[model samples]
Target: MYGPIADTIRTQRLVLEPLEVHHAEEMAPVLDDPRLHRYIGGEPLTLDELRARYAHLAAGPAPFHQEYWLNWIVRRVRDGQAVGYVQATVTPAAPEFTVASASAGATVTPGPPRLVASVAWVIGMPYQGFGFATEAARALLDRLAAHGLRDVVATVHPDNRASATVASRIGLRPTGETRDGETVWRLPRRAAPT
Candidate 1:
C-alpha cells in the first residue's frame, strides 16, 4: 500500500489533485476520447468502465497484484473542472526483469530488487496542444523528486509524438531501447547543471 498523500499541485493553467473515487464522473468523458487512446494500450473508456477503473485503482490490494498506483486528476485552475488524469507507480526491478525474461522465453536470474518510478498521463481532447500535459508531468516529477525518487521512466508508443514531446519537455531522455514495442524514456534523479 504505497499510497501517496492527497495533495494539490498548481501549474500555470491547471491544478492537479489526487484522483479520488468522486472524480470518475468528470473523468469518464475525458477517458472516452478515442484520440487519447490512439497510442495507449487500452480501449476508450465509458462511464461505467471508467468507474470500474477508478474502483480498481483505488482498492487497497489484491492477491496477485499489489496496488501501487497513485492517480491524480488534472483540472483547469480557473474553471476548477476535471480535464484528465495522471498516474505513477513504483515497480520493483527484479520482478520487472523476471517478467521481461519470462515474456521473452529466457531464464530469470536472481537479483536484488530495485525500485523504479513509472508514469502515465492523458488530457482531454479540447485541452490537448495547450501544454497541459507538460505542466502536469513536471508537477508530478517535482513531487516524486521531492520524495527522493530517482530513475523515473515513461513508455510511449513510437508514433505518439505528442507524448514523446511531453516526455522530452519534462527532461526524460530516450533509453535507446524499446519494450513491448513501446519506446522507453528515463529521467535520473540528478538535476542537470544549472
Candidate 2:
C-alpha cells in the first residue's frame, strides 16, 4: 500500500531483511523457544506453518482493506543469522478528526481513512537483552516515516513488559486503551526539526 513494498532496513548492528517464505526455514529455529510465545500465545510454529504464514504475508495485505502487511526478518550483522522479526500493518488513518479532541473541547468523530501504521517486534529468546529488537524496530519506524506515515501504533500484552519498554524507547506512549487484551501504544507524528 506504500511504494515498492517494504524495503530492507539496516541498523548499526543488524539488518531487517524483507521477509520471504524461504526466510521461514531459518526463522523457525530462531523462534522455536516456547518462552518466546509466552505473551503472544501458542507454541512455536513448525517450519511448514511458518512458511505458509510468511507466504500469506508476502502476498501483501487483503485488497478489500487496502492495508499493507510489511514484515522483515531481523538478522545479526556479525553472524548473519536470522534472530527475530519486525512488522508493520499500514493503513490509512481516519480523516474525519483532523484536530485533537482536547484542543477542540469536543469529542472528535471518525471521518474518511487517512495513513497509520501499526508495528510489532519479536526477537529470539537468546537475542533478548541485546537490544536487537530495539534496533530493528527503530529502523522499521524510520522506514515507515520515509513512506509518509504520520501515525504509528503498537499493541503489547500488559504482562509483556519487555515489549512495552521497547515501544516506549521508540517514542510510543501508552494510550490506556486495550484491544483483545493488549495495551495500545501510539506515537503521534512530530514535525521534523528545521
Candidate 3:
C-alpha cells in the first residue's frame, strides 16, 4: 500500500506536506466558509465535522481503492502556515456502481483503469485571488509527473470560474464531457524538455 510518501514538496511560494491531524484546527475555518463551499459538493463544515472528515479520510486504505488518495496540506513558504489542502488518486474507468434505466436492462462496459491525478485547493477567503490555488496545483502536478503519472485530470463545477481558470493556466484542457455535472479538463503526458 502506498501510505503517506513522507516526501515534502517545495514550490516557489509554497510547501506541501502530508496532511496531519493537527492541521484540522487551521483548516476548519477555511472549509467553513460558505463562499468556498458554493462549488464544492457539500455544505460548509464545522470544526467538529472537519475533524471527523479528516479522521475518516486518514483511516482509508493506504493504497486506496484505486491508487493512493494521498492528501496534503499546503503551507506558505514564507511563514509556514497551513493555507489549503490537495489530494490525488487514480481513476477507475468502470467504477462498480452505474445507474440503471427504469425500462431497459443494465448494460455492462469494461475499460482499462485510467491513471489520473485529481486536485482540489482552498485558500481562506482572505487569500482568494492571490494565486495560491494555482501555485499549489502546479506544484502538485509537477510532483505527480515526476513520479511518472500521466493524463492528469481536474474536475470543476462549471460555474467555478476561478478553478476553471486555474486548470487552464496549469495546461489542463477541456475534455468536452461532464461527470456528475462537473466539467472535466485533462493534461496529457508530454516529455519534459531535455
Highest lDDT against the true fold, candidate: 2
- Between candidates 2 and 3, the TM-score winner: 2
How displaced is residue 103 in candidate 1, in Å? 41
Local accuracy of candidate 2 as per-residue lDDT tens digits, 123-154: 99988999988888899888877767769999
Q: lDDT (CA) for every model shown?
A: 0.80, 0.87, 0.76
Error of 1 at 94 (Å): 3.8
Name the top TM-score candidate: 2
User: Candidate 3 on 1-194: residue-level lDDT in tens?
Assistant: 24334367788888988776677898887677778778886777778878887887767555435556667888889998788887776554444344555566776654444566676666677777889889888887887777666668888899999999998998898788898899888886685579
RMSD of candidate 2 to the true fold? 4.4
Candidate 1: tens digits of C-alpha lDDT, residues 15-97: 88876777888888777777777888677877777778788787744656542677889999898878887888866665433
167 Cα displacement, candidate 2 (Å): 0.7
TM-score of 2: 0.87
For candidate 1, give the lDDT: 0.80
Model 3 CA deviation exceeding 4 Å by range: 1-6, 62-64, 92-114, 189-194
